[model samples]
Target: MLEEDLLYVLALQRVKGIGDINAKKLISHCGSAKNVLKEKRQTLEKINGIGAFTIKHLFDSNNLIEAEKELEYIQKNNITTFYFEAENYPEKLKHCIDAPILIFKEGNFDLSNRPIISIVGTRKITSYGRYFCEKLISDIKQYNPIIVSGFAYGVDICAHKAALKNKLTTIGVLAHGFEEMYPKSHKKYVSEINKNGGFFTDFWHNDSLIRENFLKRNRIVAGISEATIIIESAEKGGSLVTADIANSYSRDVFAVPGRSSDNLSKGCNDLIKRNKAAILTSANDLIEMLNWDIETKKEHIIQKQLFVELDETEQLVYDFLVDEGKELLDIISLNCELPIYKTTTILFNLEMKGVVKPLPGKLFEAI
Candidate 1:
């Protein structure tokens, strides 16, 4: 059964024109939406923001009909509605100043347990950006963190795809409502996520995807995540908004350093330079910083044991990649305890077998 508090909060949120401040005031004075709805005009007018204008609208028969329609729509959609006091409500978000009184969600994953990390960046991500995103996400999945991102193009899609590929639970916080998934092209992926993970939003199903909604959505992403990582971002990208929010919440922010000449990298570099975020060059850097309790140290031992199965030259090359995140074929050969020709050939065989990935300029990273 839907709890009384949740039903009241949902009813309040679904009201046609009631906003956050007004909702809070009404709830504070009347004790609950159920009680507020029964209050007379004089009682409501005594509240701070519930003036005569608000009172007229509050008791308008049409507004009551609209609220009923909204509740019906929510029920039809099979969406789980949460109030701030609900057991399922996100604890972190409950503490925010402008926390939504109700959130609508559609999914099965538990949002409260998994450590969340928001991956955000420019929508105009380059080939390098995509590659970094895929590799970084793949490495981080070993720790089993929940990946969070807006379901936008470029880095956002890349992050979701990588998380799905790695079989990790991911949450796509939407700026709009479930009535329509924005960016129609992402419908298929969004459906898949609903089945396997979930989507989050503060607005009811019929709410419009306005510009201000996205700004509001960013705070949810930052507030939920334990940290935020910017893969690539232009100087004025939305990813920076998330990072700034994360910083405000005292969450760790990490940025991947890109070449200064690259416009996509400018935001990340600026974040690191300004001391807003730590520079992240490898997955291990993030893992170490978070002090994640993933059995990484044990995995290293197991990896060493498996290394005994490799030939002498392959072992040498593997060790080199493990020690240094590099792409240069020459560097591997120079550092290996073998000749260049042998080292190069072994690296190719390893790459084919899914043990390592060849980066541009012949650099190889362990898979």
Candidate 2:
């Protein structure tokens, strides 16, 4: 059975033309939806934005009956609903400027316990971008952070897949609702994520997958995560919106630098140039920037174990690349203070050992 308070709130959410801010105002003035429903038109008219037309629509018996039917539909589907006051609601999201008063959940997972990092980017990512995403996510999974994404293609899917491989939890925040998953191809993978963690949405089951819903969903993604990472995004991609929202919320934003000529890299480069995002070359950079203690302790133990194995030049190169991703020749000459020819030899050796890759244009990137 749906709780009476939740039922009333859900009904309020279903009211046409009523948005979060207005709903909040109504609730604050009337004390609750039940009370709001009993108030006459004159009382409601005094509130800004609630004119006679809105009051009439809000109070119509037909609308109330339809809302009750919608509540029944939600119950029939067994979807769990949460209000902002619920203890299970995400605390981070509660502080968002336009936090949802109610959220509908369809899976079994504890959202509050996991540290979330939202990974977003272009739907058309390059092979290099894919590799960067996979390796970084694989490295960070040891800490068991919950990965959050929009379940779109490219870096979002890559991050979720990597998280699954590492046996970590992942959640996809959909723009629509539980009635159907968008871009249907993601259904299979989304099922896997739900089995591991869960899927989240704020819209009702019948809500259509509209464009504005996605922009709104981005806020939830940003709010839920401790930080946001842009793997690869074009100059005008949704990932930029997520990054902007994350920054607005005072969360760390990280961007992987891509080739300047690549169109997809423009957004990332722009972010770096504007000093809006930190340049992330590796998982350790994120760990350090976020002041993550788990990986730091683990690195200390691993360093002690490898103290004697690396030669002076190899050690210098490795140290430089350990917490940051660098171009092959860049680090060798920059850190070891060696010539390009000598650096190339060391990079070749490192590549042979599965530690680095030759990126486009003589640039070597560490794995």
Candidate 3:
């Protein structure tokens, strides 16, 4: 966004009682942030859900003055701001209704067309959780996915470190603004994180670091990715909140299962029991569930042959798969008028001959 426009956006963010959803609503109605500030209270109140109280502070001149100060800090620091509607904003996050209207980014990472996943869990990570978290990233390293986390203790930092060790970009979403770093010990890791991926936040330079800020920051960690993985969590924690937000966004939520007696595993187990999250056993489970394996295959070229050997049922299934390009296992079986077991047997044979490959979510395609 331009400097003049950013000034208005920052002002809108500073307006008391006005938040991302309302700011977006006002912006949509007025055409721009500048117009929203200039619009009359009576006119704004005419819009549905725009109560008198919402616009009570709409005409505050101090908003613009404060915004100007923030803008100056932004310009001097070279911080990149992402307008909610801008092309450069994270695509998945854009679809979220409650997503931040503006996000300050501080990284050189390429987010375009990359599969992003959020890894979160309890701050008191155990050896079991650490092993699982690291292994998960390592297994998926071939896909070169971008790993996202809160950059706090436990699973968050573990996931980031695993991503860096694997030479993959990892983003650390902060609960506070750029001016303050929570858990001061993490200051040393910021340099490496920026070099690998970087930090993101909606908080301003002078925003305070508090308990509620962490809860609010969970949304970004949840909404910015295709999936959110909870490696380990106690019965109640912030990671569970992030997982809930991810589910609310209609994104995939995966929880690593643990023994019923394990304290840290209770939250993940409960999530699975309540059907809020799918069971995540390994990287393959996630790879298949999100169709990452299919995406990886699409990046490669595969040659086709007209004279590949196939028996009667195999030919029928092969022809159906070839015509459809890709299909779910059940869909393929139903369409081919074959029993699921028989279809599975044929698909296995085809896979052995490099004719078809199985994907996560029980999807398959002719190669």
Candidate 4:
């Protein structure tokens, strides 16, 4: 993005009452952030859901000044910004209604990993939760899914370390700005996380840490991934809130079941009981639910002649399977750069031609 465009976006973000949703609305209606700021009050008022209170500070000069300073800070610190309407933004997060209009990512993480899963739970994690978190990541490391979590204590840190150990990318979503690291102690591990994945936050530089900010940041944690997993929680906590947000987004949620007598398990049990989450017993539960299969082959393959006639799209999927050996439907679609529906049709055609066969767990292989 151009410097001027970023400046205006920052200024829009600095507005007191206008949040992501309203900012998006205003920008969509006016064409751009600069246009929104330059548009007259009468015009802005005509836009629905943008009330007097929301736009009262829209024209504040102080917002622009602060934005200018923040823009400088962002440039100096080498922070990468993801705009909502841009292709560079995370694809899964783009579908969320309340996703951040501008996300500041500080790290070398790649966001292309399919089947992103967010693991969240009580800060006071139990031994069981810790064990489950570590083992789950280790088990699914082969699938190469990115693991996401708040960089808080207990389950979050455990998940991150486990992902690191398994050489998998892990993202830490933060409540504060890059200028300040919460829980000061975790600062020691920031370098490793930046190398493996990185931290994501919508908060501006020097934003103070407040209790409410944790809850507000939960939306990003929930909205940025395909599923949210709860390791352990009491009846109430920030992780439960993340689960609720994920549910609201129509994303899958999984809760590791625990003993009824355990205090930390209450929140997860409640979620499962209310049908807010699927009971996650192991990595297989998540793998199967998400249809991410790592099983490479079935009992046997029906050999096909070398000269099977195939069109361009079918050839693409066929070559991908031949090279990959075996892969899930979504993986094939992603690797071949084809849509799932189109890939499914191509796979069906290949199957009819006796060149491909569907295995269990939605996997397919070249025959």
When superposed on Cα atoms, how far off is each prediction in RMSD? 14.1, 11.7, 6.2, 7.5
lDDT of each: 0.78, 0.78, 0.89, 0.87
Off by over 4 Å in 4: 294-367
TM-score of 4: 0.81
Q: What are the TM-scores, per candidate, against the unseen true structure?
A: 0.73, 0.76, 0.82, 0.81
Clashes of each: 4, 1, 1, 0
Residue by residue across 195-277, what tens digits does model 3's lDDT show? 98999999998897999999889999999998999999999999999988987877788999999999999999999888778
After superposition, the stretches of candidate 2 with alpha carbons farther than 4 Å from their true spots are 48-56, 294-367
- 199: Cα error in model 2, Å: 0.9
Tens digits of per-residue lDDT for model 4, 1-367: 9999999999998999898889999999999999999999998998999868889989999999999999999999999999999889999889888888999999988786566999999889888788999999999998898999999998989999999999998899999999899889999989999999999999998998899889878999998898899999999899999998987776788998989999999999999888788899999888765657534222222234345788988888887887776677889989888899999999999999977866533668675
Candidates sorted on TM-score, descending: 3, 4, 2, 1
**Model 4 collision count:** 0
Query: Which of 2 and 3 is ahead in TM-score?
Result: 3
Candidates 1 and 2, the one with greater TM-score: 2
What is the lDDT for 37 in model 2?
78
Off by over 4 Å in 1: 1-7, 14-18, 40-60, 294-367
Model 2 scores a TM of 0.76
